[model samples]
Target chain A: MDMQPIVRVRKLNAWFGAAHAVKNVSLEVEPHSVTAIIGPSGCGKSTFIRCLNRLHEEVPDARAHGEVFLGDTNIYGEGIDPVVIRRKIGMVFQKPNPFPAASVFDNVAAGLKLAGIRKKALLMERVERSLRHAALWDEVKAKLGSPGMSLSGGQLQRLCIARALAVEPSVLLMDEPTSALDPIATKKIEELIVNLRKEVTIIIVTHNMQQAARISDRTAFLLLGELIEFGATSEIFTVPKEKQTEAYITGKFG
Target chain B: MITFSEIAAQGYTKRKFKNRLMCLLFFVAALVALTPLFSIMGYVFIKGVGSINWSFLTQLPAPVGESGGGMANALVGTCVLIVLASIIGMTSGLATGIYLSEYGRGKLATIIRFSADMLSSVPSIVIGLFVYILIVRPMQSFSALAGGVALGVIMIPTIARSAEELLKLVPASVREAGLALGLPRWKVTIWIVLKGSLSGIITGVMLAIARVAGETAPLLFTALGNRFWSWNLTQPIGSLPVQIFTYSISPFEEWHRQAWAGALVLVLLVFSINLGARFVFRPQISRD
Candidate 1:
């Protein structure tokens, strides 16, 4: 609890053309902890996480005017590469996006291969390790040669997680990774996330309140592009300071 | 008076009858649409396939009144022309397509896109005349190079627009996934976005090639046809389409038969290219 934060944001704002999406949001994520971002739909929770890796600016009209620090370095400083920044902060999407044309082994090894790791032995080792970390090794080991898209939805999601993990990133950002999953699959991913928290700082944007409460140590509530409250997960649930937060948590209104 | 149920049943029967009648009408319309196409194929196969043999493929056109001959020079020239044109076309087309789909914005992309669409609709004969004045006249000769350049010019707009549309089908998420891996934007575009739509791009390329295979108007002015086997690209060259036009209009019946044989070869060449492309893409299509 006393550890220094691995990621910090100060007055971060995102704009999609003329429309402001994330306005002056700031938070800190300590290493080896899971911080859940909770919000209703269209609340900029997804946009906020996207900014952490500088991915929000991919759209031609989308721009970010804010400071995000990974470790001690500001990611948007002059000559700082977004590609390099993203390498340290890996991301998993809401819907599973395993490379359709690649094999299961190649999908897990995609990021590593891009980084120029061509040695077969080294690739095999890393792929196996990443798959194990994502808790998908045993299930997919025999089928490593199969096309990545041939897997079930849950397995594809896990393969994506495995792909993200292969690069050995410092922070893992997930945007509602389990929203597309069935209950049993969601439970499995939740369990995997809990197990994964020991090695990296995890920040997850989830609309499911129970999921946030179950998996996160800290929770940040966002509404209409504003961060309304941030607190320890237990206290946020028990003694919410904002009425809007209380209303949202109690299901009185989204 | 009829009961309410009986009235409802009569209405249902009337609607059902209409539906059946409409289905029959659609079938008849479909047959009408397809009959001409099949008849053309049937007629061409019957008339042309007989003249196609090994010697007809390998031998040069018989001297004036002789019986045995082949479009050997034309076949080879068509290949050289198409290959040259494709090389020129694919380079410009793919580069322009990449710019149109991924890079350019504002007024420039719109202008280029509009111009490409307009160029594709221009008549091939007009394009041939334009090529004749611009290239063949300047070069001071009707050469295979000029002919290839003409076809290449025609290929650019079609291939570019097709490539652009196909590249656009690549999901934004795929770009994000590639960029997230720390690869540069251009590398992600070439390796991921372009690779993802490669099959579609190839389909476009094949279609463009096929269209040029049957075009005679462009070659009439640019290549100007040769009587002998000539490999010199800077000199006049024989091409199948031009040969077909020349022989079909000739006074001799034997030349007409040779033209039919040449037409058969051209059709088979195009058909095989399309079939070969489909064969190559089967594994790609099997993927989810």
Candidate 2:
């Protein structure tokens, strides 16, 4: 374990109304590493990841208990704006949802504009850079003024990633970013994630064990709102410490 | 195999009656809806075409039984009022809708939604009277501004409720995508949610304009009517519906003819606006 982990979760509990979505689970994410949260459906992996940035607050009855720290800063402390936390910790959702009304250029520039960057030349430069980082620049460079909805599903998802990267956040959260993509797009995004880890810390929630083993340095196994195991990706896949993790990896049960 | 003909005969008789009954019911329902539409068109054209002339449209309203007057000023007033009302109604309604759909979920939003629904159900005449008390009497006179404001009041609830419903139709994933990019709440609503629901909002605005344009009661106590051309917002103005209301009641043949012509123009105007909105806002259905 590193002396100063970038993100630390301690005794974290979450509930959606009366249903406990995330149990008292604790974990740490080292700085500048790709940590994959792997679990089957309804195992609270997504909920757990969402709690890091307080994204669950949008749900009417969603509530959380305990603490989350971003580099020693208590994320849930009083007077701390979730908006600021979210800006620091950007997220990409399960599906590709580019702003339908905006042009490709505008979609990439959205976060920058929100941060009050007004110079058009600077915005264009950053948008191009982010698009290139997301591996979408070549195909969309000529048609940056076109509506984002005109892009293919795979392209739109990458555009979303570019939009996320445009704001230059410290931590990037991806919730099944490639689940809706085809094999080729998924491979490209996986490659992008590997490249992105050099510059930004990443927390990815994926169901594909192969993907987690291929890209993540560390992996966390969650089941039914409880953290079953957390360790190096190779150990979690090959020699899990817990029987539940072993059984899950061996296709015994989700 | 043993008695195929007899089985066929039994099945055919049982199904034949039900099929005929269903066809008859469907035919009657279709007729019930189509008859009034066709008859109204027929009646309007038959009576209105006689008065549809350059003079009838360009001249001013004459005395009670006299003929040879135009509805040009009334038509212009109606256009200006409806356009202004639509602008006010759409902007305020869309803002209220975004607040309700995006930022609101608690008691205040619930109350606003409830009031909006209640207001939509209130009679146009009641809205007119309310505007009269609040606006007309306060100003101590009826004016086009008062009329447009009253029409805007009637329009706001309809547009706001429809826009809110449209905004609700947008999937939450779209909002999540914008938020995940660290976009602020207002930016997400304006850039994503509002854009996604733009077509639906336009439809609602157009429908609101159509509803208000045909209303005479609201304008009765507000704009009143002008005998000659008047462009001033602070003075009484002539409009199609109020003109139709006044002309339809007179016993003179010429006034009756002019009323029919005005009604035709009003219907045509509403129909064209609706058609234009549908043409502009309906999503493109590309083959690819």
Candidate 3:
């Protein structure tokens, strides 16, 4: 916990046309740790995480004004390439989207290959290491030539993780990565997230409070596009400082 | 009071009768729709099959009142024109489609989309005249290049519109996935989005080509039809549709028969192109 923060957000505000989505949110993520954002539906949890990688503005009429620092560099600084920032901070979506028509090996190696890396030996090595890190190499090693879409739901999500990890990003942002999964698959993903903490910083957005409490070291609560509470997971669950947080935790209302 | 079993029995009989009636009506409607298509093919086959012999295929057209002749020059000319048209159409059409689907939000894209729709509805004869004024008039003679340009113009709107729709069918998530890998926008579009939609684009291109293959009006003023074999783009050329038109208008009954044969050839060529596109560019739906 003595290392410099991997991601630092300062007074971020985002809007979708005339409607405000994320309002005046600020937080810092420690390196190689898991920070989970929890809230009800439409609380801008997804929007907040998307802003870290500068993907929120991709939507028409959607814009964000903020300063996000990756290590010592502000990602939104003048003349900084959003594409480069995205490579440094990878993302996993709620649905498992493996590039259609691509093989398992190609899916993992796509990032490296598109970046002009042509050496086959290097691509093979990176694809193997990334699949192994995502806990999918054993199940998929024999079927690397198969289409990525042919995998089971859990396996496809893991393949996406492997695809993201192949780029060797410093931070991984996951938006409700396990909501679409069954209990067993969800358990596997939770374990994988915990195991991945030693290699890269992780920020996950989730609606399931139990999932947040189980997999996260620290938790941030958002309500109606505003940050309500931010603290250690144990402290936030057992001793919330805000009344809204206490009500939400005690099953009073969303 | 009626029992439940009695009510169920009554409803079942009524439902069964209704279903059978609807099925019969649908069958009749389908037959009505297919009647014209089948009759045309059957009539053409009966009329043209007798004239399509080896001599008719390999030899040049005979002079008036002669017994037999083949449209060898027209057949080769049609193929050359199609190749030239495809090059022009696919390049411009796909580029326009990519622009419309990927980065088309502003006024320029709107204008381009509107122009494509408008161009698609303009009569082929009009387009022929336009190309004649643009190319043939300047060159001071009808040429195969002008005919190809006319056909290429006719192809662009259909290919562009269908390509845009096909590219749009690719989910936004796929594009986002490519972008998240740090690849530039153009690379993501060309390598990922366009590649995934390739089979559909090929289908669209085939449809456009089929539409222009038998167009005689455009080539009438542009290529002007040639009796002798010619491959030079600067000189007049012969095509199946133009040959058929010229032969059908002649006073000789022999020319009329040969015209029917040319029509048959043109239809077969278009049909085979469609089948070939489906066979070669079929989407890979099977898993390894």
lDDT to native, each model: 0.89, 0.88, 0.91
Put down candidate 3 lDDT per residue, A1-254, tens digits, no spaces: 77788899999999999989999999999999999999889999999999999988888999999899999999989999999999999999998878777899999998899899989999999999999889999999999999887899999899999999999999999999998899999999999999999888999999999999999999999998999999999999999999999999888887
> What tens digits encode model 2's per-residue C-alpha lDDT throughout A1-254?
55589999999999999999999999999988999999889999999999988888777899998799998789988888887888889888898877656789988998888678999999999999999989999999999999887888889889998998898888999999999989999999999999998778999999999999999999999999999999999899998999999999898986
After the best TM-score superposition of candidate 2, give how far the Cα of residue B182 lies from its true spot, in angstroms: 2.4
Q: If ranked by lDDT, best first, what sequence of candidates would result?
A: 3, 1, 2
Judging by DockQ against the true structure, name the best candidate: 1
Which ranges of candidate 1 are over 4 A from the true structure? B1-9, B280-288
Fraction of true interface contacts that also occur in model 2: 0.49
Could you tell me every candidate's TM-score relative to the true structure?
0.95, 0.90, 0.96
DockQ of 2: 0.46
Cα shift from native, residue B109, model 1 (Å): 1.2
What lDDT score goes with residue A129 in model 2? Answer: 91
With a 3 Å backbone cut-off (N, CA, C), the pairs that clash in candidate 1 are: none
Q: B110-206, model 3: which lDDT tens digit per residue? A: 9999999999999999999999999999999999999999999999999999999989978898788888777888988988889778888999999
Chain A of candidate 3 gets a TM-score of 0.99
Evaluated at residue A138, the lDDT of candidate 3 is 98
Highest lDDT among the candidates is held by which one? Answer: 3
Candidate 3 regions with alpha-carbon error over 4 angstroms: B280-288
